[model samples]
Target chain A: MSGTSAPATAHGPHHAGPYNPAKGRLGMWLFICTEVLLFGGLFLLYAVYRYRYAEAFHAASGLLDRLFGTANTIVLITSSLTVVLAIFEFERGKPTRARNYLLFTLLCGLAFLVIKSFEWGAKFEHGLYPNAPHLMSMGFGEILYFGLYFTMTGLHAIHVIVGMSVLFVAWRRIGKGTLMRTRPAFLENGGLFWHLVDVIWIFLFPLFYLIS
Target chain B: MAETAAHAGAYGEGPYFNPETVKPGPAGWLTTTNHKRIGVMYLSLIATFFSVAVILGLLMRIELMYPGQQIMSAKVFNAMFTLHGVIQIFLVVIPGIPTIFGNFSLPTLIGANDMAFPKLNLFTFYLFVAGAALAIGSCFTGGGAPDTGWTFYVPFSLKTAVNVPLATFAVFVLGMSSILTGVNIVSTVHTLRAPGMDFGKMPLSVWGLYSTAWVQILATPIIGITMLLIVVERIFGIGVFDPTKGGDPLLYQHLFWIYSHPAVYIMILPAMGIMSDLFPVFSRKNIFGYKMIAFSSLAIASVGSLVWGHHMYVNGQSDTAGIIFSLLTFLVAVPSAIKVVNWLATMYKGSIRVEAPFLYALSFVWLFTIGGLTGMFLGGLSTDVPLHDTYFVVGHFHYIIFGGTGFGIFAALYYWFPKLTGRMYEKRFAIVAWLTTFVGFNVFYFPYFVMGWQGMPRRYFDFPAKFTELQVVSSIGSYIMVIGIAMIIGNLLRGAKKGEKAPDNPWQGATLDWSLPSPAPLENWDVPPTVTRGPYEFNHSEDDK
Candidate 1:
């Protein structure tokens, strides 16, 4: 790392190109580290409530549809693969193929969101969301479980949308040929982020749906 | 870019202020990627917020003068202290040493031209400004400033009519700035060191920031999420921590302390690093137990995180958890004690300079020791039962934060002044200011330790008539301390533009920074330097000077 990185400083200030794509990996990984902890915080909250109200959490988990959870999991995981393939193709000098792969990633993102909203809507129609009339009508443990359920999933959905937006931009820029091998950090980082969003859903799927 | 015509040195090398800026004045400042200018920008912002907090503190002191509605109503007093805490913690201290000195010197110390992410560095500064503006704006916007205290303990924070969502959101913004800065600095150190400068040979100040950057990266996110939750609870009516909705209020505390405890190390570790650098220069000797002092920084950062439960001891953490936390808390003291001992050992049997920075360093050793010893009292569950929220806790806090980190900052300013400006402040005024601040500080805060032990609770707008004498003394001391601070700041500001040119190699330091121009070159060096030995090898630098 030192051998490779120190040369930028050695180049002196005027010509020292500090924005090499490799350094972007360090920055993006650090950012991804923070994102994991951001969700890690909610995970902690879930763990605490899960410990305190194991039976109630199990009961509440039954309310969420395993079929929708399974479908969204497949869509999100497939989206991550497409993002990686997009980057893979871009690195291989196949911009056209990369754009196609990124387009698929965005489509998968949309499908996952559509599936997630349907799942949420089914619960909402039954008044099972946080502070809902029916959820409040249930036991305190159930209220706690569904409260965490919506918060975690709601937060995850927001990340999915953000990831799709990033990839969408990358797809357009790739089509425009603005990205180059020397500085493809933008798409590379976007792919890492898309993977994280998918990975978080992977955790969310089993934690909520499989618990039942 | 050529607007300044203020080349840095005799050879007319780099631009004096900013290298990439296209405009002269404020526009140049706003777009600058120069770490020195960014450091100055942070200084300017911190000075503004510190004054506001100090004034709020003095007003609180005035209200406590005779204890019975001396100046303000109880409700107003609550708002004042809350504002003070919010401004001081998020605005002034959390971004304290590392933002100011680390930005200014870290690149130069490691012989890099600038931070690895210079544009991102400027972005963080602007982000900090926006966050600070949001925090300041919250004082007037919704229901007036929040009165739920800085901790913003849940249920109350949820229930408060005062504007908490805006304050929490402001904190969230500030946390984003802190996290990005951590990313930038960590990358700067990892990738931008001089040719031969490995981790071991790097200055303790860099190590201090390196350790602190990790803490900032790891711990700050937790606070960011927690603060976001506060905003979420208020805006979305989430019952995540509302006890009436089956949520536990204790969870709020657990989450708050998780980040906040590590934050104390964030505040002090850099200040400790400044001392590690200062002791070697003043004493003209190799730093004693250099590796121990360096590793202690990392040790302190690690152990500091585990002890957050200690803050919750009286708040009803289980006895087992409290015991575990208490033991971990004591473990932190070991590394801290190692640092203090090593500092004194470095000064032993050497030719000591006793300059302004060294004087402050000496003061830091004793005052911080007092703060640390008193912390031992509060860390124990048995003794803490009495002192948890009393004036004693308040006194102990002021000693550690104000006496310790605050003095550490003053010492650094004095030490770095010549290097930053190519000039020197009046030594006589510096001495006088330190004396007044020291005497006034002791007189001001010492009474709180005594009054608190006698059972005077903190944050009270009124107190018993029997405690009148101590309160009067404290208020008087606050006045003196404020005057002293003004003098110290006045002297430095005066020195920057008008003081005599800095003597060639004033401190005779061995680090790479000391080898550079007094107000160092804009890019620090045309070619990055090569390191050959440890940071404190003063044996060789004497002849070079």
Candidate 2:
């Protein structure tokens, strides 16, 4: 790492743009690396609990909507593709095409959220919310299992919403010619983040939907 | 923008004290991309929090003057300790180096014009402020400040009377700020090095921060997510940590410590970096084992992460897990020993000067040695079981955190004060403050180590009269230490205008920071610097003057 401080003696301050866009993108990618570790830590917690209370987790997983989670996973992965394609459009100097791709990605993000709301609604209707009165009534393991699932997946959904908003803003910026030149780092970084969101869902799909 | 105007040299430059030099009040400070300004802003916030927490600490001391709830109710005492922990950990110590000195000096030391992302740097400062606001604001909410202690142990945290969710939310935001700053610095170090300054050629301070930044990036997220989970548990009644709904409170401790223990390294590694810089400069010698010190930082960061379970030895961790944690915990001490030995060896046979920063660094060595050795005593399961959560653990950490990290901060402040403010503080005043602080610090925390060994539990308002004498001495010592703190602040504030002028390189140090004027120009460097002499080249210069 370059020392964060300035050199003691040098000719003049301004150098040819110390801000390299590619490195900027790389910095964001590195940020997601940490985010992955963070989520990985939480996932480890889930895994250990699942191992310890496999019957409970499995039964709890049965309560979650398998079709809804699978559908949302597909929606997110599809959005991830569009984001990549949008970056590709920008790389090829096709701003209009990139805008269309970004729009599609944003739409997919919104759709995923919409489906998530539906799933949450179902859970709420079924008294499956976290720490619901019926939680302990079901059994200790089952309550613990559902608790981890809701906390993990709910937090993941919040991130998706945040990711979607960032992308929507980037989409508008691209159309305004702000991102047309030099391939917007915003679009690139946003794509990386969207992909992370997708990757989290990929893990979530099996844990919440497929395993049971 | 206007690069030329910002790049003027010594006589060619404008007046030494430009009206524009000090950031223009609140708005200028809020929007400042200037690292020095941001450093000052962070220090100001830290000081504010420190003052509040210190008052709370003093009150806790007074409450313990008798035995059972003398001045306040048990509930209030709980809040006091909780406030003290939260303020010290989240508000002050965690941001100790990086936000203050790291922000101000990191870009300057590297011979860069500014941080790789100046705007993002500003955002970090703002984020910290916002988080602090949220955290402190929770105190006034209907439910009152959180009483979960800084650890926010689950079950209690989720079921506490306080508005813990809001407090946890604040912690979440503050954590993000820390992670972002870490990422920014890592990238800055990666992308913005001056020419000829490769990884091995960098200064020790940079090395320390680089390791710290990685810890912040990697470990902070676990804590962030953990805090978020607590909030979720509280708000939505998630059973993740709630005992009634199959949640295990033990899991919360595991997750919390996973980040929190590594966090202890985050707090001290940069300070160690500060000592690494101060030791050689004040000693007027080459560092003893430059690579060892650099690599030990990484060692501490990695090994530190694996030892969080040590905190749980007495808290009900499985014996196998405890053994693994104990082994890893012992491993951490080796790197710490390497650092201690290397620093002492650096001072041997060297032309050492007793400057204020050097005094603090020396104290850091002496006190951190005490802290580290005592830690070895506790690392063994036999001793820890008896003394866990007693005054011993409290004293052990204070020695490390206060004696180690706190002294390191003072050393850094004295070392870089001139660079940040363009003024030389009173040497005698600084020295006097250091003496009292060093003496009072030992007097204060040393007894706790003894009382802890004697089986005095921590956080109790009243104890047996047998422990009273030491408690009284510790309380008196606390006052002396506070006075010392007051003197240090007084010297800095009074010296800002009344002090003498500092040369660009007052210590004649060889680091890149000495190459620039104090209160560096709007832009950092005229051009990126090239490295010629190695980081440890005290003997290379024949002209000592």
Candidate 3:
């Protein structure tokens, strides 16, 4: 995986010749284009519905816990920081340090999700979730408002899980010494995916919890 | 990672790379990372599903033969068409040309031995199978078949009693597969091209795929998220696109067209690439306006992605937006028109080979031109008002997708029959099949333009008595077309198994593929290949730099 191609195993024929990190990097970026557009669709919805029901969206924003929203945002941003640091350690030949950084980043991802669940649970207890009696009473605008809130944030949560899974794989590969300084694509691409997850939340934070 | 010692020793030195010789049976093929074997795998699946979709089309046409239900009830008709649209679009055309031809020929086209990510390529094939299974499963698992069209328009999609969630999830899975394939192709082209073969020297098909990969990566995800949201809406009644809860169905139209329109390009651009390769080889001439044709592919991908709004003109989108979309839609025709002109110019005065592949390519140009020209009428804001959702729309797309892309697939099969299987098909049967298909295709789709101009709506199982005669004619035409399709499939399949051995450079093609030995090896080139000249330097007849 360094300069040479990975061997063909019982897995059948493999791409011969030397391994190229740029190829992996480019492939990951193209994948990020899809993830961005996937989230872009949701953001377009937020823009449309927000334009339609400005007053109701603003009032619904007031109901959400800014403390918890701000806390989760900080947790995600810190996780992005750790991912950056993980790659930095990979660059410095300190695989153990990089591994620890990745573990921390993953833990931050979990913490972000745990805090997200509490926020969602609190809303659920207030009968604020979609199709609940009180949310139905909240009328069309608020129901739609909460519906998008859960949809976008819930999707963001799923992405958080995926990013963690990517980091986990990177962590395992790095410890196996296949994804080190000479072959850092696995770790580097994992960092790229994590950054995407973090950036999507930055937009989601302002749109739902902040702009609201 | 230091496997050069063992890899170089074992690479390309053993088996002939044909299935007959290269580790045979399901064990070797099912887990293959070799691009060639993966291509054959895709071909088998595509052929099977194509037959299923063709049958659905025939049945629907038969049902619409008379005024009232001829063979199926209105409900069954709805389900059939829905499945027909879903299967043909996702399982066939969208992935059709790219995965099969791209997998089989791209590395050779670019002079690389394997894709940049081989394991990813095999994983992508499995992803396709998984998505396809779930999509077909949606038809019979819970409730009844999915009645909402492939678009899965909102409100109805959410409220439908059928298994909408499972169906939409299948599309999500499919979209993921498409996105990964796109990513792999882009990376392969960027990093794996033979040394010295820059973008300018690369085959135009590589250009088409490079552009298509970008479209697949960027546009497919909108539909992926949209489909996922459909499932979300179904399970939670989120009312995101449900009108009763203040959600706008128009938003659904916007989101759907955002991907579906570009998807049409995903279906055709590669076919156009095939046309690019075909015109030169058959003419034995340098491809005219090579740079223009190459840039136009990029032009098509970029300009084509923005024209999705053209589909939403009558769906309550603002007139300013509609007019803007209409203008952009018109712009897309320019690049398409340029490519067509260049192809004709490529064949203008050359010594032309009147072969079956050439016949299919000729039909593609003629039919695709009509499809594009008719698209202009529908692109105009005023003209679209009448044609929207009419049989006109249906006919226009069928011309592009089936006539254009489908024929391109046939041409590729005929043209590469020798390279792929080391055999030449019975040429007479191929031409007969092509003639039958050409005649049958026009007969089947052309009447829809007339009926649609006369104001016949689409997706309706029963038509008025006034429309009965043309409907019957269309049904008969489809029967002829299906026979031709079957013959085309049968001839090539029979040839692959038992035809005469084909000579290298069977078409005397000037491309790198012709330089490859018959039944091109499992990993493509025996050693690393480096291309020096332009792809269509037929006079030189060599890509060796």
Candidate 4:
């Protein structure tokens, strides 16, 4: 894909006119704000339910594997650093290095997802999945807690996968020289999105895994 | 080349000036990224949905005509009303003015060739179509259409065997579409304004869209997540909103209204902006308090988000919460009132032209005033309890949304018909349609206010004998409204086909849109326009017809 010398504009007809980096960045920020609100609603629900059933929520939080959660949090924070470095390298005219950092970010994303799958697998083995017979028999607050746990983390993991795919695309584009420093909005937006995913995880980790 | 010449001959302009050739043919329409084509597509899509929803609404009224399962079973009646609410709110009013006129005119009004992100604009359109399809498709699947009403309040939404998940998912998609459009519009306003077109110099309509875009971006995600939660609860039996699972239904209401309340501004702000532009145009005067009108739109969007709790007045929330929400609701009204006053003051002593568009705008003022004032009744703690679920609440909202935004659309369509179609509608028929619709609308909805005040609960299949007379009256009024709406649609279609060709500047306006040829060219302007005057500068010598 990178070998094609299609003059970059062949990326699509939508890229008409001079690219406005500021507009692209502003649009990304606005989108990030929206993602915050999206997760904010779920957080509001957690807060309300946690307040209502404090003891059960603590017990439910205890059921989560903090080691896995902590490891995933560190992995996400490392990924955030890699994405930032990727942007730094791209802007500093080091496309190969930026691509390598993006690759590392993508790896971290995979690692996070693999760890998440293992954790979820263990929960499923315990029959703690939402509305499972075992979960249905649990205390109401515990049921609600696990319900929110899966939903929130599941949504975050989807974001991680999406962010990884975006980084992969940016990496490929940078290799093709289509996403050079002159046309860096695509890479910048990808980095911003990855950071948002990390920031959301930062919130989710303490709320869901470490609250107890 | 042949197609180009054919359009040139038809439109009296060559390929160099035609906007339609950005793409050509049926395939072109589906794939076209031109804002004009997308806008026209939205008009058609919205009209189709509006027609279906209107017909469904008429069916509901027909059943209420005689009461007690007159034409359909109670279950069918529930489905009809639910679909009606969903369709009208999501597919019609919410997207009404902004997607239609805003898409068509915003870039031109600001002297941009197209939206900042034209591709994203087209994507938003497709999202709308996909959402509408899913919403309508739900009717044929999984125990038929959802009967849980548009709100889809918990406990019931969770228990319904109907396709609540599909419907809610449709809403989620639609919300995404609304947010993306909002982002596109806001970005356009910020980055695409013509040289010298400062924010203050922008048309009030632009300001209206700007404010609405903020609401759409900020408020829509809450509802998007809320709807997803509902889908989650339905599919996974998560107790996020289910009472059996330690969920509080009130949380759903809170989350729903948090977005839904500000969504009211999303529906009406652009319409209000249209009025701001129209009053100055028809009155042949500069808008009174232009800054106030512009600022009020922003104020409305800001304050509107905080008052969602007003919708929960009867939901057993704390009185302190209700009082706070009620006060904030009343506070939101202040900005709305300021706009009304400014519009009226603009028309106070000017040379007013009573055109069809102007007539619709005038009716919007009257109807919206009634709507707004009645809203005060619903906003106050003392009065809302009696009117909470009554027909009064229904009447108030229809007056605001249907009467306000709906007529705002009619006004914009008539005002821009010549510009949009490059043809003049029959003036007399246009006025006739307006008068009939105006009269019929008041007659139809006013009775609901009376009946609601007299204690007729909404969404009921049957009522007592004492309520029979007013129900029949309201039904008759709806029939008249149907005829009037039919006439309006017929006039526009016929006008586009055979009406007289419109001149470039029919209204002698000063906005950048008026500077363009009717059926504005593909790039909107061959050369980017520079603005040296305000959007409502009526005193300019060239505009002094």
Best by DockQ: 1
Write the residue-wise lDDT of candidate 2 on B413-484 in tens digits.
899877767889999989999999888888888999889999999877679989888988898888888889
> What ranking emerges by lDDT with the best candidate at the front?
4, 3, 1, 2
In candidate 3, which residue ranges exceed 4 Å CA deviation?
A1-14, B1-24, B542-545
The 10-residue segment with the lowest total lDDT in model 3 chain B? B1-10
Q: lDDT per residue, candidate 3, B415-513, as tens digits?
A: 888878888899999999999989999999999999999999999987889988888888888889999999999999899889998886777776666
Task: Give the per-residue lDDT digits (tens) of candidate 1, residues B384-481.
Answer: 99888999988987888888889999999999887778889998889998889888888899999999999999888899999999999999999999
Error of 3 at B213 (Å): 0.8
Candidate 1's docking class is medium
How do the residues B1-545 of candidate 4 rate in per-residue lDDT, one tens digit apiece?
01112123232133212444545567777887778778889999999999999999999999999757789999999899999999999999998877887788998788666787888888999999999999999999989999999999989988889999999999999999999988888877877676667788899999999899999999999999999999988888878888888899999999999999999999999999989999999999999999899999999999999999999998999999998999899999899999999999999999999999999999998999999999999999989999999999999999999999999999999988877888899999999988898888988999999999999999999999898899988998999999999999999999988999998789887787776667666555433555677888767636457
Better of 2 and 4 by TM-score: 4
Task: Compose the digit string of candidate 4's lDDT tens values, residues A37-121.
Answer: 9999999999999999999989888988999999999999999999999999989899899989999999999999999999999
- Candidate No. with top lDDT: 4
The true-versus-predicted C-alpha distance at residue B498 of model 4, in Å, is 0.6
List where candidate 2 sits over 4 angstroms from the true fold: A1-16, A133-136, B1-25, B68-70, B539-544
lDDT of 2 by residue, A1-212 (tens): 23343422343433323436755775797689778977886788788778888887777777887788878888888889999999998888888898899899988988998898898888878887665676657887777667777777777888898898889988889777776556478888888888999998898789877665
Alpha-carbon shift of residue A173 in model 2 (angstroms): 1.1
lDDT of 1 by residue, A1-212 (tens): 34245445444455334566667788889989999998888899889988988888899888888999999988888888888888889998889999999999999999988988898889989988777888888877798888778888888999989988988888888877787856789998999998899889889889999885
Give the residue spans of candidate 4 off by over 4 A: A1-17, B1-20
Question: Would you estimate the TM-scores of all the predictions?
Answer: 0.96, 0.95, 0.95, 0.95
Please report, as a residue range, the 10-residue window in candidate 1 chain B with the lowest summed lDDT: B1-10
